[model samples]
Target: MQPSPLAAPDASWYDIPGVRLVGAIAGALFLVAAIRAMFGRK
Candidate 1:
């Protein structure tokens, strides 16, 4: 069986110094875009 991708999330993600914060910002932007799309398509 194939292993799960998120089995060790903390260990693999954002090992670099400033990458975690950038990831957070990107996530927030994606969420905002998703919400806007959801609301605007009505």
Candidate 2:
């Protein structure tokens, strides 16, 4: 079933720069962890 018109997803509720920075940091952390695991380092 589809969402109602009043319940449609909205993209304007977020602070763009804040969201981007948080996402970037999380991505970087994930990459670093992956690299460390692959290299068998603590």
Candidate 3:
């Protein structure tokens, strides 16, 4: 049988330095903006 197509996630995916926090904060802000836009809030 062929092995499962999905392999375990790479450990290095979590090893990024410095930019992780910035990316997370930016992502959160983007989500907030998206939600507000969707709800037509000021």
- Summed backbone clashes in each candidate are 0, 0, 0
Write down the RMSD of all candidates, one decimal each: 7.2, 4.5, 6.2
lDDT of 1 by residue, 1-42 (tens): 887985864665567667899988999999999999989686
For candidate 3, what is the TM-score? 0.54
lDDT of 3: 0.79
Error of 3 at 38 (Å): 0.4
**Colliding residue pairs in candidate 1:** none
Deviation in angstroms for 20 in model 3? Answer: 0.3
Model 3 is weakest, by summed lDDT over 10 consecutive residues, at 7-16
Instruction: Tell me the TM-score of each prediction against the true structure.
Output: 0.58, 0.57, 0.54
lDDT of 2 at 22: 88
Q: Which parts of model 2 are misplaced by more than 4 Å?
A: 1-10, 13-15
Give the CA lDDT, 0 to 100, for residue 10 in model 3.
62
Is candidate 1 or 3 superior in lDDT? 1
Better of 2 and 3 by TM-score: 2
TM-score of model number 1: 0.58
